[model samples]
Target chain A: MQYAIIGAGPAGVIAAETLRKTDPQGSIVLIGGEPEPPYSRMAIPYLLIERIPETGTYLRHSPDHFQKQGIEIRQDRVTAMDTPNRRLTLSSGDGLQYDRLLIATGSRPIKLPVPGIDLPGVHNCWTLEDARHILRLAQPGAKVVLIGAGFIGCIILEALAERGVDLSVVEMGDRMVPRMMNQTAGNLIKRWCEAKGIQVHTATRVKGIESRSGPGFLKRVTGVLGLDAESGSANALGVELDNGHRLQADLVISATGVQPNSEFLKGSSVELEQGILVDNRLRTNIPEIFAAGDVAQGRDFSTGGHQVHAIQPTASDHGRVAALNMAGTDTLFQGSFNMNVLDTLGLISSSFGLWMGVEGGDSVEICSPEKYRYLNLEFQEDVMVGATSLGLTQHVGVLRGLIQGRVKLGQWKDRLKRDPSRLMEAYLAQNAVL
Target chain B: MQRSLHIDPEKCTGCLQCEMACSLENEKVFNIAKSRIKVFTFHEEGRFVPYTCTQCDEAWCMHACPVEAIQLNKLTGAKVVNESVCVGCKVCTIACPFGTVNYNEDSGKVIKCDLCGGDPECAKACPTSAIAYIDANWTGLDRMRSWAARTDTSARA
Candidate 1:
């Protein structure tokens, strides 16, 4: 049997390794688009902070690890896939046949259509190439304007801050990480960043980017006179804001969001919603084809409805389950729980499952914004459906345990309603009873 | 036969020798904070329970690792972290349900119990046989035998 996996990210790599272990005789081909080795985009932040070298971003360190396992690694990308013919065409003009295919093609950053976005100094911190460009311009004291304040953006914020760049963050939403965090929690993060000497602008939008016209005569004259250090270097970008303010930026990082890289599946007859729709088995509507990672919109643990969880944990879990089924193990995928744990300038915040609280559901909150400590619980009857916490890192897994285990709180629910900090006690009590 | 570290929480006296041994063995430090095995104190209940990586058959940390840094040692059945390749993403720390896998901020990598490559120091240092290195396949055999002894009428007399 021949297994072809596209997009050599975590999901695709894991699936290839799993297939090798499950069916030793099967031929596997893992395809990646980048020229470099299969690496994790999640490690880009660490790379930016100089925590690790380029080799550290690799999904596998050994140069011949895949070759040793007899799994062929191809650096070409899929141009088009003919699902009916069980074949795929590569960008390098190569064609391949396969018995099973996995679309782990992940997602790409959304490029805003504004003018001057394609300029050299502007980049999306999505790939290794992008990180190299960022490092060249994001030097200490460099004026950097970050486009979004979401999860990915916040991570980039930490790296940029660590690099000692004069950073300014602009968010379109009312608060930071608007999708992953609530208002009070998000604003607290903004305040924390502000305290750490980073300028944060919320409820704002970047109108457009305009390149500073080639140094004017006076500026050129100043450069010749050795008065203006940055003059005659024509790469400075002017970021126009909706609020009628313009900020001069040496580097502009666009981290607005990402969309599934499923454009190639336009007429493939494989289902596509927000992403490629897959069942609990990670199988697409097409029988021989499957999807995983950010490209797969599988089941949500709390809602039980199909949703795209583009997190690392979900990607790895989907890969293993999909590979088992691909290898004829007949495994069922447990739905992914929606969770986000973030650290912004030393303040840790996390949210799990239906943290926003369902309609008509009972909710409790303890917000000590002054101390940057917050805990909120959402409940449907007696069971805790979701939880969010800031600065409460001890035994945080108990929140996950209670939600994932679907443990009934019984009378303990009332005690928790009075004090949500008793999560450890509640978890231990439930474990003891069980 | 593969061996596994088994912990009987009841036998624990909360002495924390296992923690000291684990930290010293893996991190070359006496600092309990650096220990792979942690002893949680239940001050109100006057009990302590020691916990670490179970080295599960399908270890979540191994699969969750984007890089193949966590690999299984065939002889010991221990999943060990190759720190050189680790990018310190901390994804495994969240993926682990038992929370045994943890991030080491100093090294910018993760650390977990590797059973000391089959010669577990925690089991050796436990003054009270609270932790034992036993056969992996028969982890429950001792408990089953004890129940059998309880039901034996000949011994009861």
Candidate 2:
């Protein structure tokens, strides 16, 4: 059998290796869009911190590793897939036919829709190329303005601050990491960054990014959209906020978030809602085609519905399952766990399961922001549905265990509500199956 | 036939003697933080899983490196990172599913277990037989050779 895997990210690479192991004689091709060797986007921060060189961002280190494995690694993008004919059209004007296909295209950074966003200095910290550009401009003492204070933004903010740049963060949300943390936890993080000497603006929306050419193209674009555009231009690259404030920026970075790289799946028969929908077997609607990693909307542990769990571990798990099924060894993905453990400027914060409490569920918050410690737990009936903790490392794996195991809290729920610190006892009482 | 390290998590006591031995032998220090092998504690489940680089036949870390810094030591079948060539990008750290590859802040390059050039320190230091370096093969030399058997390509005549 011939196998063709797309994206060459974590999922695609793992699938290729698994297929090679499961079926030693199968012909395999790993296709990637980037020109460089398959590298990890998560490691781009280390590159920015000067901890690693461009070569360090590569996912593998050995030369001729792919050739040794008998797998062909092609650095080409797939322009279209001809599913009926079991073929694909590549950007390099080549075609590949495969008995089995895996889509692990991952995600691309969402470009901020602002006028001066197209400016040379404006960049999104997503790819290795972006990191290289950021390093060129994010010099120590450079005036940097970063848009969005989400998880990705916060991580970039940490890297930029370490470079000794004068950084100002603008977030429309009232606090930082709004999606991952609750208001109190978010406020604590914002205060921590403020204490570290970062100028932060919350509850403020960027109205426009104006080039010296009189508000750039927003004037014309907004005029067509029938929205009021800013009247005048400024000497430097100025960011106009809805709160009637302006900030001068030497470099602008957008780390808002990412969208699935499933655009090519469009016009194809693959069912997609924000991302390609895949069954527990990681199979798309078509039998020969499968999707995994950030590009797949698989089963969610909390919602039970399909949604993209765009993290590294989920991507790896998805790849293994997809490859097993593709290699004719049937395997089913249990479900994608929603988990995020972020290390932001030495503060380790993690969220697991449905961190936002489900309706009709009891929740508890243990806050000691003074000590940079906090824990929030959400319980539905007799089990822990979700948890969010900052500055506590030991509870992270345990919290995931309880939630994933679906352990019944029994009477410990009342004790937890009274004192959330009893989590260790509660965890031991009911879930200590060891 | 190739020797490999076989880990039994059930026998792991989490005493971290293996970690200390690993650090002392390779890094010349006793710091646990600097240790290559890590013992992950599952308090709720009351289990300790001591994890390290599995020395995969087709190692992900070795393949992922762009600089070709991680090279296969043919004798030991271990992928060793050349610090001189490594740019310290930490991409290998991300690529390894077991999280064995680590970045050294002082050196600005990543590090992992190299099996102590065939005589591993972790296996010797283990109080329990949790980590055993034995004559067990991972996908053996034979299985790897079988891949060659199917190929139209061959060794130069």
Candidate 3:
């Protein structure tokens, strides 16, 4: 049997590895669109902070790891796919046939619809190549203006701060990580960033990006005229905000958000909603084809409906389950929850499940902004449906366990409402009772 | 036969011998903070429950690892973190429901119970048999035996 997996990200790599383990004799081809080795986008921030080299971003350490396992790794893009014939057309004009196909194409960063968004100094910190470009431009004392304060934006904010760049963050939302954290928690993170010498502009939008001609531009002119001068010297880019304020920056990194890379499936009979729709088994509308990772809107733990969980852990789980069914093992994928644990400039925050608190659901919150600590629990009857906490890293996984396990808190619900910090005790009590 | 680490919390005395032994075995240190097995002190209940990685069949940390840094020890059925490969993303630390996977600031890699490569030092150093390396299939055998003995009416005055 031939298994062809698209997009060599975390989901694609894990799917390929699981398939090899499940069916040793199967022919596997893992196709990655990028030219570099299959690497984790999660490691790009570490790469920016100089914690690891470019090669360290690779998913596997050994260069011959895939070859040793008899899994073919192809660096090519899938331009079109023929689901009826189980065939794929590559960007390089090559045809490939497969008994089973897995789409783990993942997502791409969304560039804002602003003027000068594609200038030389503006970039997205999504790929290894983007990281390389960021490294060259994000020099010390370089004025960097980052657009968006979402999960991806805040992560890039931390890395840019570590590089000693004069950083200013602009978020269209009212606070940082608006999607993950509630208002109280998000504003606290903003204050924490401000305390660390980084400027944060919440409730703001980038109107346009204007290129500034200054001393740096003269250097570029000199280099272009065959003078023995350095080329591509950084110049300040004016980031005009909706607030009628402009900030001069050497580099502007856009981390607004990402959308599933399901564009290639435009006319393919395979289903596509916000992402490719799949069942609990991760099988798409077509039995022979499957989808996983950010590209697969499989299941949501909180709502019991299909939702795209664009997190790494979900992608990992989706990959393993999809590979099992693809290998004819008949595995069912229990849904993935919306969970995020973020450490921004030394402050830790996390949210799990329906952190926003469903309507008609009981909620409890304890906010100590002075201590930079907060905890909010959303309860549907006696069960903890979701929770959000800031600066409480110890044993925080109990929140996830309670929600994911759907444990009935019983009397512990009242106890938690009284004292939200009793999560560890409540978790222990529930497990002991079970 | 695959063996697993079995914990009988009732037998624990909170001596932290397992913690010290674990730290020494894996980190070459005597610091309990470096130990994979943690002894939580529930002061109100007057209990000390020692816990670590369960080496679960569908290990969350193992599957959740983005870089495949966490691998299964085929000999021991233990999920071991490959430090050279781990980028210290801390995703695994949160992915684990039991919170057994912990991040080490000193090494910048997450640490967890590797069962000491099958010969677990924590089980050996446990003074009260609170931690033991037993048959994976019969980890509940001891509890079952105790319950069976409780129902014994064969000889009672």
Interface RMSD after interface superposition, model 2 = 12.2
Worst 10 residues of 3 chain A by lDDT: A227-236
Error of 3 at A225 (Å): 5.8
lDDT of 2 by residue, A355-380 (tens): 88999998999999898899999989
Task: Give the candidates in order of DockQ, highest first.
Answer: 3, 1, 2
Residue A151 error, candidate 2, Å: 1.6
TM-score, one value per model: 0.88, 0.75, 0.91
Residue A434 in candidate 3 has what lDDT? 16
State which candidate, 1 or 3, has the greater TM-score: 3
TM-score of chain B of each: 0.86, 0.83, 0.87
Candidate 1 segments whose C-alpha is farther than 4 A from its true place: A214-235, A363-371, A392-395, A410-425, A432-434, B15-17, B20-35, B41-47, B119-121, B137-157
lDDT of 1 by residue, A49-163 (tens): 9988988888888899999999998999898999889999999999999999999999999998787787657899999999998887888888999999998999888889999
What TM-scores result for chain A when each predicted structure is judged separately against the true chain A?
0.94, 0.92, 0.96
The list of candidate 2 runs beyond 4 A from truth reads A213-236, A411-434, B1-157
Ten residues in sequence with the least summed lDDT for candidate 2 chain A: A227-236
Query: Interface RMSD of the predictions, in order shown?
Result: 11.8, 12.2, 11.9
DockQ for each of the predicted structures, in order? 0.18, 0.09, 0.23
